[model samples]
Target: MQTSEYLTNFSAGIAPIPQDQWQALAQHCGPFLQYSFLNGLETCGCVGGTTGWQPHFITVHRHGTLVGAMPGYLKSDSYGEYVFDHSWANAYHHHGLNYYPKWISAVPFTPVTGPRMLIHPNADKQIIVEKLLEQAGRLEQFGASSCHLLFAQDFERHNACHAGYRARWSVQFQWHNYDYTDFDGFLSALTSRKRKDIRKSRQFLQASGICIERRGDGQIRPQDMAFFLSCYQQTYLKRSGHTGYLNQEFFEHLLKTLKNRLMLVIARQGDVPVASALFLYDDKGLYGRYWGSLRDVNGLHFECCYFQGIEFAIENRIPLFNPGTQGEHKILRGFEPIYCCSLHRLFASEFDAAVGEFLDREAPVITNYYHQAHNVLPFNATFRAQLISSPENKKGHF
Candidate 1:
């Protein structure tokens, strides 16, 4: 076993971790794992200081070499974690046990999952995962009642189970690119009925004179970002009576530092931008992060958020498109349901078995729902056959 000293080094922030070292570990993970993106969250006041998200980043090093890292927080509340655990917290409350200050590793306010536990390519991954869990559990000493790893990658779920943490599964709708050449090619792969439905939606928007376009890489201008933030906040205010978790400075900070990975799909009505969505992409995937609008036009949301992302993914050859979370509407539009995982280890022995039992009961129902959701995908027979035979389905991806 690797020495415990080589693991469990926690810092209050990611700012001190050398950028090059962090990027080397994050390179294949995705753009959200980039040092700039993580640090931008802190530096821009989106997190830290009374946000209930106290940054508690972890890095493992061996002989002065960075080996692994995870985005962690000492969460006082569970508002931002998409892996809902409010019921668990309430359970603790009923029993007069504290659930606040649970340690978690996840990207803040971003539900489109990729990776949370980041490891260097050359490192002993199995060893790192083991030690990481040890350290997370050890946070109990700092008053953490439990440890949670949210939206972790699938293989990490297996590792966590082996390490004695109970695995919890949730489903999210995501799109998979199967070598399409363009938007029309993508539509061609869909069932005739669904294809016509999507086509009509597009035509309705096009005929309404709502122009949709995408800007990415260096083309996302400052004004474009400002417009997106306003729409984003406006929508949040209408729904929740507050601006979204991310602030204007956070947007600006990411724009300056991580703009290359950023994308904007803007919908305009005759030269006036009315709606927009923001995405983060790398060579691996296109992640739809946020979308908002000044005007709600017929079919505009689907055209801007889903159809545009599908087209971009096809053009860019990005193999996956995860358009945020919890939208069954996406299933009818070709997005398929897949399992997302979270791991929990409550320090209280009594609660541990209860939570474990709860998770076990929930897993099959969630998995069954995942399998059943496949029936509704808009794919044609050929595409459906391709999906059934695909290695992802065969592996079951849990």
Candidate 2:
């Protein structure tokens, strides 16, 4: 398809694409691009401007058939995006420019990396990307200083780099499920000290009389949500000046509709709930979304958020656990440095060139950082191999 005919802006003409095509796109692109998943983000009201997320989704059609789509936004501020550009915003401010109302293509709030440019099966990805750039070229009219595509897949990341999207890399700790028949098999691969430490952590949770429960869908009571929010609030308060981006309704809606894909790990003491971690999963992996605790307990966060999720993944056979982003702490718990990707398209030539140069300088540092983080893994080479080996993880399957 010619790029022009293939592209259309839907700022005011946003129409619901048929479910079949949406699912087909996801299946063709694989699980991370699932329709139910993206649609759920919209249906839950998380992506609309009422919550500071304004969807400006872009689509491509070939011969009147849906072929590609990019879930984008006219972001007024940079809150939900895991990739940070506050420096650029600051620079723009110092130069008397406004950086708000920029364009972004990403999954809101969730930073787990997969596909960002949703391409249909057999579609010309190059054309899709060109059309995207063409639309992004017009970002200045929307008062956007630049357009950013976060956590794009490797191919799209490279393509964007070549097409003038400055590339930036960040390290996120991810637990890859090696083929382990069970949790014990996983622990057996750890070094004696790390293994013992994890075991003792679990023991402490038990000794503290903490009971962990997994709740899904309608089974999540109002009290569960309330407790989770309390823990979540406490997390922000600890950070002085931290303001939460979401409200209770968001979780309520997620629990109601995305339940099968939602997993809530709640820790309770006697009759009181203390800590909770919220995770979302599909066929490919488990995404640990939020974790909060009202009271501090030694190793409690580790046990609840990392270890328990790993056990669950092993039991259910989920392949990976992206326990949120930016956690060096996760590395000690067996998470590896997986590079999350993003792309940028600045509108003004001089600004674009400047940002492009800035990204070139930054990308290597980001790359080197991930490489350095890799050397700090908690296991010996042999144990690391066992942890990454497929059969070891599938055996314990979540």
Candidate 3:
């Protein structure tokens, strides 16, 4: 079974790697990158078959001992990844090239950023990165036109850039806890107008006879999950004319395997659930993943998704809240703009150069948008003064 002293192997699925061993190497990574989460996607049929995501997990071993791994998929279409490449695909089509089958290293349907290259703490990072890039380059043999590492960590993105991948930039809104005491304390830092607007939203929900309940771990029952899934599918159907990317089995598996890390916020009117927001968290932060409503009440979406997540983070002492992607609306609700990057390597040289030129032209615009968005943050003068006075502010950490 042993091939070489140092071997890099790509599995058709993650089933080959032992869960405990793989998890040990992935220490400190987020729940999305965990063994259970990725495996659930495969086992529940959310990823395989006609879903267009085929697991192609990469693993590195030395003397038959696992040292490095990455969650990878052979994607037939650019559907779930938040890093949009449909334009690139169109460009390929205009050039009379194929771009359908591509390789991506990311958590399917999850846009939150973390480590794409999962390396053991004691492993040589540079060597692992080299082996990974080598394997990515070999995707051409499998009829893949490109390899994308989406929503990668800063270090991994930099490494990929050094290894000659084109860097793509995007922005997401996230709320940070600056030692706030509670939800009211969080609002105190916001501008007067924003504070009033938020208060009005909450008042609308309150006056509608809607009661918000936060359920986590042991409190989240099977009925709650079923209700959440119904709402999730209904929302997706209304928006996309189809059900969601995830199925009930996928969510049920997540609930069973990642119970403690999962949190659900249910909005009820006189003992009947009307809406729900699902979140995943660790000690570091909370991530708002999915939300849907059986009934529409004014300002209900904002209260269920953003405000509830903020309250939960504050009460639990979690530092940050990433309320999913792409909304200028979140900025006014106290979520600040955060920069995220992805890396890509196209197999065709001519297409690669063209895409590189496009990215070069696009980078400055994205940077400018981020800066503009930062100026519009709703923080009051006192909070702005506090941020300016902090040492981390000097380094532009946020």
Error of 1 at 65 (Å): 2.9
**Which residue runs of candidate 3 sit more than 4 Å off their true CA positions?**
1-4, 392-398
Q: Candidates' TM-scores?
A: 0.95, 0.87, 0.97
Clashes of 1: 0
What's the CA RMSD for each of the models? 2.1, 3.8, 2.0
Pairs in steric clash, model 1: none
Weakest ten-residue segment in model 2 by summed lDDT: 389-398
Q: On residues 1-398, what C-alpha lDDT tens digit does candidate 1 reach at each position?
A: 53755746887878888889988898888877788888989998888998999999877888787888878999999988888888889999999989998999888998766677888898888878776777777798999998888888877788888888888889999888878889888888888998999989888888888898899977999999999999999999998999999999889988898888898999989889999999999888899988899998988888888999998899889999999899889999988888788888899999999998888899889978988897677777886677667776653422
Question: lDDT at 377 for candidate 2?
Answer: 69
Highest TM-score model number: 3
Tens digits of per-residue lDDT, candidate 2, 1-398, equal 44556645554213377777666566644333566556656765656746667878777777777777777788888988889998888888898888888988887787877777777778887887777667667778878888898888888787777877777777788888767799888887777888888888888889998988987534677677778887886887786446365566667766665667777889988778889988877668888878888888888888778888898889889898888888678877788888777788777677778887887798889888877877776675676565367463542311
What ordering of candidates by TM-score runs from best to worst?
Answer: 3, 1, 2
lDDT (C-alpha) at residue 240 in model 1: 93
State the TM-score for model 3: 0.97
Clash count for candidate 2 is: 24
Tens digit per residue, CA lDDT, model 3, 1-398: 23345698898777788988789876589888888988898899989899999999888888777888878999989998999889989988898989979999999999999999888887787787777778778889999999999999988888888888999999999998887899999999998998999998898888889999999855899999999999999999999998898899999998898999999999998889999999999999899999999998999999999999999999999989999999999988988888898999998999899899999999999999998898888889988888878976643633
The alpha-carbon deviation from the true structure for residue 95 of candidate 3, after best TM-score superposition, in angstroms, is 2.9
For each candidate, what is the lDDT? 0.86, 0.75, 0.89
